[model samples]
Target: ANHGLAGAEFLAGIPGTVGGALAMNAGCHGGETWGIVERVLMLDRNGALRERTAADFEIGYRHVGLRDAADECFAAAWFRLPAGETAASRRRIRDLLEKRIASQPLQWPNAGSVFRNPPDDHAARLIEAAGLKGLQIGGAHVSEKHANFIVNPERRATAADIEALIERVQTRVREAFGIELVREVRIVGDKA
Candidate 1:
């Protein structure tokens, strides 16, 4: 809440470190992390850190410039928020969280959105249309409360179950709509 800059309220509801947020350009309610960035501090493999302008990045939806240069990474960031009231920023945060809780399956254990909204269409709508909501594979179930989310409501979803469910959702949606649903969440490692 220390960031009382004008328009910094958009970062209120996002969960993660500032570097992670900047890396993904995470946004919600029409505000994005990179939009507030004035400059960034990056570290190379050799422990050398340097300041870089926004121009140094090839930023886009859910990505930062370091994708091609894995040797360097984000260490810190400098924001360009203008002065504003802390109270107002806090209120905005509250409002954003309230809005999130109302629509998302906050009662369950889950990762956030599983797929990026494809072009002009929303992923949640597409998933819902595919009749995938509430579909369960073992302990992981596509959330009925929000079609885009997969929840481990019992806290028993194995990593493998979650991975299988994600692939199944992608296939089903593609078969039904002929549009390949691109994943927003990064998947890595061998399946257990």
Candidate 2:
């Protein structure tokens, strides 16, 4: 049953490197990758290698805290799980996939969720209430189907386009509802 089960079924759909998964604790639905992590192997800048237990790092929802040591990289991870019915787990995974495809704006090149759910509140509802759905900035637009997502409808959007749209949405939501929406997507690189 252990081999037949689909406990890590969500891992099959995520598009990220194993190192990214370990660093970000990437997950879908309610299953986090870190929940099953048993141990990690890391390499330092000087090429020194070490093994650390899961308890060695601070694991949080969708995030992992690394030590202050510079030039460290994740080498690999070990996972643990119990057995389950293979067919049933596969069916559950399929159902989840179907639901996501139907409800999310996956047809466009938008980063998944723009903002994390605030304490006891959903980001989508707040954005919708601010009248931001379908709002546009350059080639990027807020997905009408899902307010929390910003899609590049024109396919010509730069990172600046997306960043501006996100900030506009955040500002509007804050102004209208008095609640600050915290972004889920990590914005990197210099400003354009």
Candidate 3:
């Protein structure tokens, strides 16, 4: 935005890195990372570098995967952004940041949104409707500010606590609305 790019302003409030954004096809307010990506540099497990385009990957809501199924990670990317006034772009960023602070659980340690929105419905809406907000499991709790967020406000929640809370939210939402909430955050490792 300092460069006066308009399309990337949606990224201004995301908490993770570019690589993570690319990996998850991250977006908010209808602007996905892959939507602006023109080309990307990837490093394979063997340390070989290669360039790929949008066509080289299968892209979907909150998902991206190499069509060739190669093991690789994003190294860099070139984006195609439209030019806009610097001031306007900066204002958009500021507005987005303010919106995030107002709506999200910024004071606690949490993964951004915990679940993908169901088709034609928001996960937060379903979660809140299911009475999951402020629901606690051990030291982690569903954020009162945003039902989609699972926050470790005291920093004392174990990974297991968060995981259990995630499952609890999923189960309750499913039972209430008959919609399965897909996770937006990835969990990897041996179970404790």
Candidate 4:
């Protein structure tokens, strides 16, 4: 944004690295990471580097995966951002950041939005409508400020606590509205 590149202003509001953004096709404020991608450098587990374009992968809202189902990670990317006024891009980034600060539980430990918004509806709204706000499991709770967020205010919530709370939220919302909430944040671990 400082260099007058347009279209990447949404990245300012995202919390993770470019690699994570690419992996998930992360987006906010109407622009997604994959939307500006020209080409990408990928490294497979066997250490072979390959260059691929958008056609080589499937991209969608908060999701990206190799077309061939290759086990690889994004090593780097070349973006194709259009030229724009530096001041305007900076202002856009600032506005997005401000909006995030106001609506998200930034002061507490969180993994951003827990669930992907269902078609034509928001996860936060559904969670709130289900009376799940401030719902707790151990030290983790659905944030009162933003129902989509599970906050660990004192940093005392274990992985099990957070996972349990997520399941509870899913159960209640499904029972009440019959819409199954799909998680945005990926959980990876062996169950004990």
Candidate 5:
């Protein structure tokens, strides 16, 4: 891992930028991004960069500070990770990648996990148990391989398709298990 960061290895195979990851507190395999962060560099609308430490900003699961409506954007991050053996680090990275492939729907165009794990239970388990696997709305389908993933098979699924499927899944899970599914995939923009 760069800068001898212990947790950076856990992010192997994750497709996204550091800014996005930091904003979401992105993690997998029990390693969160903020856990290794020492300092953050933010840019404002005027292109001025400001340095802020971890304590200067609020940190939580998939949350970051707003700087009180300052409209700052993440520019860079400095990680504070400990050194470790090179070979062991590489192996651990490979292992985590394998784990991700086996459990995630990586073959399709999808935006990672659609819902967060609720408490002591996994969202996939809940969805699969509800008999929602292989369900599709338009071209977007809940992955037969992993219920938590909504895949755009054939790359023909529109935003509406994905959004509709997400809503359906949420409704069904709520009705069946009495648990409201909170979306983890951030949605932006309006229907064109």
Candidate 6:
């Protein structure tokens, strides 16, 4: 069972499926889905099945790399957890969820924060200081509340528009602060 404990309760709010969660190592707040993983059940293309330990894979912040098995796919996972106070865990989850609702643009169709924070400094602070908050390119605009987030105000923005805006923000931030902002959101498909 997928335990949505602590700050991981945000996983329940995410619209993606379990398969996507596995593929992306999806997490939120301070909780990572893979942190509690003990073992994973996988199936090969030829229908062969196997069980592998979490230690058998390379686990990172938002990525998991399997060893020499690109053709295999995760079928399920065994997660180990310590017995804890249910009330406390539920309270913590509630608090984290409240914090996320208050801070993030949950009402919008955003793919979440556009860039990851670099080192000790925050990407939002950098973007805001660079005067990028509330900046807009077509229907895509940098969120005024959180500079690191780009929101779709009109919901009709093309990929090119978002790409251009992201590039502009990166360029401006780099030119002003000499910090290169790396994108967190994966951009796919051809540019229009």
RMSD of each: 1.9, 2.4, 1.1, 1.1, 1.8, 3.3
The positional error of residue 4 in candidate 2, measured at the CA in angstroms, is 1.6
TM for every model, in the order presented, reads 0.91, 0.86, 0.96, 0.96, 0.92, 0.79
lDDT of 6 at 135: 88
Pairs in clash, predicted candidate 4: none
- Candidates 2 and 3 compared by lDDT, better number: 3
- Pairs that collide, model 3: none
Please, what are the lDDT tens digits per residue for candidate 3 over residues 1-192? Answer: 677677899998798899999999999987899999999999999999999999999999999999999999999999999999999989888998999999999989988999999999999999999998999999999999999999998899999999999999999998888999999998978864
Which tens-of-lDDT digit does each residue in 62-178 have in candidate 1? 777753555777889888878989888788889988999999998998778888899899999999999999999999999999999999999999999999999999999999999
**Full-model lDDT for every candidate:** 0.85, 0.82, 0.93, 0.92, 0.85, 0.77
Model 5, position 1: C-alpha lDDT score: 55
Q: Model 3's lDDT to the true fold?
A: 0.93
Model 3: worst 10 consecutive residues (lDDT sum): 1-10
Clashing residue pairs in candidate 5 are none
lDDT at 68, model 3: 97
Candidate 2 lDDT over 64-87, as tens digits, reads 776544467799888886778878
Q: Which ten residues in a row have the lowest lDDT in candidate 5?
A: 1-10
Over 95-114, each residue of candidate 4 has an lDDT whose tens digit, in order, gives 98999999999999998988
Could you give candidate 5's per-residue lDDT for residues 1-192 as a string of tens digits?
A: 544545579888876789888887788888889898888999989999999887766777667776466788899999887887777788899899899899888988888888988888989999999999999988999999999999987899989999999999999999999998888778879851
TM-score, model 1 to reference: 0.91
Which model is ahead, 4 or 5, in terms of TM-score?
4
Q: Which ten residues in a row have the lowest lDDT in candidate 2?
A: 1-10
In angstroms, give how far residue 52 of model 5 lies from its true place. 1.4
